[model samples]
Target: MIPNLDVDLLKTFLAIADTGNFTRAAEEVHKTQSAVSMQMKRLEELVGRPLFTRDGRQSRFTADGERLIEYARRIVNLNDEAVAAFTKPELTGTLRFGTPDDYADRFLPEILARFSRTHPLVTVNVDCAMSPVLYERSRHGELDLALVTACSEIIADEIVRTENLVWVTSQRHSAHMLDTLPVALSHTGCEWRALAVGALERQGRKYRIAYSSPNSNAVNAAVLAGLAVGAIPEICLRPGMRLLSEKDGFPKLSQFRIGIVHRPGRRSSAAEALSRHISESISNMPRQLMAAE
Candidate 1:
């Protein structure tokens, strides 16, 4: 008889995968570190394959472990869905959700679709703006929940994802090769703009802000049109954009974080449900960014 995999074990396994550390996974799952290890061992035995291999002090997923992530997420999600459907009251309410324009373009569609399917009666009103604007709205209680890029100036309730910030230019253009680089970026006070300009300054590369806008779509359009080079999170990269690297005389930029913040006090069922969907959807995204060849 085939052994049935335990949902509890799978949850613990997913925590480890999401956190990438046994200690952190234990904290997430509310289990002792040793207990988390034993749970992983049991899971491996059930599957009859080693799930993780140690690299120095860190534990990395093996090929089978990587492959099982999708199956585990689906299984756990379905289990939760069944339990929620039977045990909980149907959620119904209007939720005010805010996010930066760039994040909305890349992540909102999947998050909203999955959430609507689970809570059909919940209405999500999306507001797209700059991160600072969203942060202010969330703090003012005007938005129920906001997803923003984490920056030093604002404190986020929870960080859901992190990725490299890369320089991009049009595939057909030589904008990066220009003597005085032309940059397309968000308006003043944007963290991405600051980072990009600072990096260029440190490299002693002369650059001018050729295009500036609060809208990510406009910035991307300038880059795609080969009018200027722009910096964006790896996940936000478009199909026609080419990455610039140190070899291209571009300095490396640091990783940026995506975080979610909720209004203070009690959260409505709709807000709670959407928050869970956002966290799960983002945490399950591919962690590795595409490298410049």
Candidate 2:
């Protein structure tokens, strides 16, 4: 036996099956009730079967309709899956994601957690390093996507999130000591380090690196010990640390424009979902992040 059926008819049938009411199914499909009734009649005539038993405006699928609903769901899902696999972009291989040091702690878990929930089958490989290092790697295709600093070069096709840079010193330290270099920072390639150093250079203020480490926690620890003034995200400053504001001639660390970057091509559903989650999470950062100084 041959069945002549259109995809739209099947979609209508599915909607009717789920909603269990002609009026509701018509609304679900954005069709007028009369139009839906006509289509259902046409579909039933073509299949030589009464798909639903109707009592006034209410309807219930017949035994054959129950069997057909399962097949319809499979057929529709498979058709969509096939189109996505071939016509759309297929992204099933291992996805390498790069991220800077502190963001891994601050953001990756939420991003990856949602990503894994959505795409449980895809493998996510995270490469965490300093920002400049990851940016270079992403440029070379070593990583498919990265959380990177948004300098002019990478601004296009980037997802930008703004954060302020503040000087954090141990609460025990006197505010006057800020004149001296109080904290060490990451090595030469770090974005925060560049901002901090550049601001000092512009101010013509002489300062020394009290302690330098690639690890942000290490820098925080140094500041906690009153070894030096560490520049940190206003969000990340520990409770015991004092964030110096403009009254202190605030060494003017520029704001960080951070975002995700990828190669110039279509992204996988998994990657797109991850990127969206990251954008949402960062944009809607907790009030703690922008708390008043």
Candidate 3:
């Protein structure tokens, strides 16, 4: 008899794959780490193959685990789509929404797909830009709601998610060995840029900006090509990049607070519903998917 794989278990498997560790995966699924480990054991038994190997604290995926990810992503998306279509609530009207590029690329598609299924009559006008711009625009009533990357100084209406900041480099790169650490960073005004540079300066570490771009892809490319090292929201770090620790001479960085800011005052029923939907989707997102990759 062929054992039927549970969708929930598959979901958990993908979560582990995404975060590169069982503990982070457990947090995403609202399960204890021990429970996650137990689930993995059960899953491995079902597959009848070893699926993970220890890479320090990281759970490096075995060949089977890697293959399962492609299948898992498809299965989960299809399952979610079916569920959304059947359980949809009737909603209508247009919604003006804004999000930073990072969030937009990572989770918005699935969120919007579900929203479209649940509220077919509602039109969502989405603006994709930097967090600061989105937050400012929403504050001035230009957008009904916005997702912003909240720095310590920027107060937000509500925080929907959080991410640790970490240094990452290409697997083959050793830019940290240079006398002047080469950094791939965002533009001058980006909060992340300011934070990374500040941290380095405070530690008296000399670094040169080897590359700078507003587009995260360009920044990541710089790191991927072994030209430089960069800081990213740990949740968004993709596969192929190795995370560096303080032991590797990288300093600890502040956590990123993902905040939801909505226009002040009463909002339309559609807006309210969509806001709730967006918030839920974001808050429930697994750390791995937050990386646009």
Worst 10 residues of 2 by lDDT: 81-90
Number of the candidate with higher lDDT, 2 or 3 = 3
In model 2, what is the error at residue 122, expressed in angstroms? 2.3
Q: Rate the local accuracy (lDDT) of all candidates.
A: 0.89, 0.73, 0.82
Weakest 10 consecutive residues of candidate 3 by summed lDDT? 284-293
Residues 236-266, candidate 3, lDDT per residue (tens digit)?
Answer: 6866798888999889987778888888788
RMSD in Å for model 1: 3.4
Candidate 2 residue-wise lDDT, 1-293, digit = tens: 78767778888888887787788999999999898989888888877888888767567778887767766654664454455445543346578888866777777776676555545567889888877677778777787778877776555256657888888777897632656655578887677888888888887777888788888878878888777888877656666788776677666688888888875567766767567667756764554544434
Q: Kindly list the per-residue Cα lDDT of model 1 for residues 1-293, writing each as its tens digit.
A: 99999999999999988787899999999999999999999999999999999899889999999989888988898788777766877898889999998889878888988787778888889999999999999999999999998889878999998878999999998988889999999999888999999999988999999999999999999999999999998888888999889988899998888899999889887888888899988977654433323
Top-scoring candidate (lDDT): 1
Among residues 3 or more apart in sequence or in different chains, the pairs in candidate 3 whose N, CA or C atoms overlap within 3 Å are 236-291
Residue 208 of model 3 has an lDDT of 95
- Give the clashing residue pairs of candidate 1, or none: none
TM-score of each: 0.84, 0.63, 0.69
How should the candidates be ordered by lDDT, best one leading? 1, 3, 2
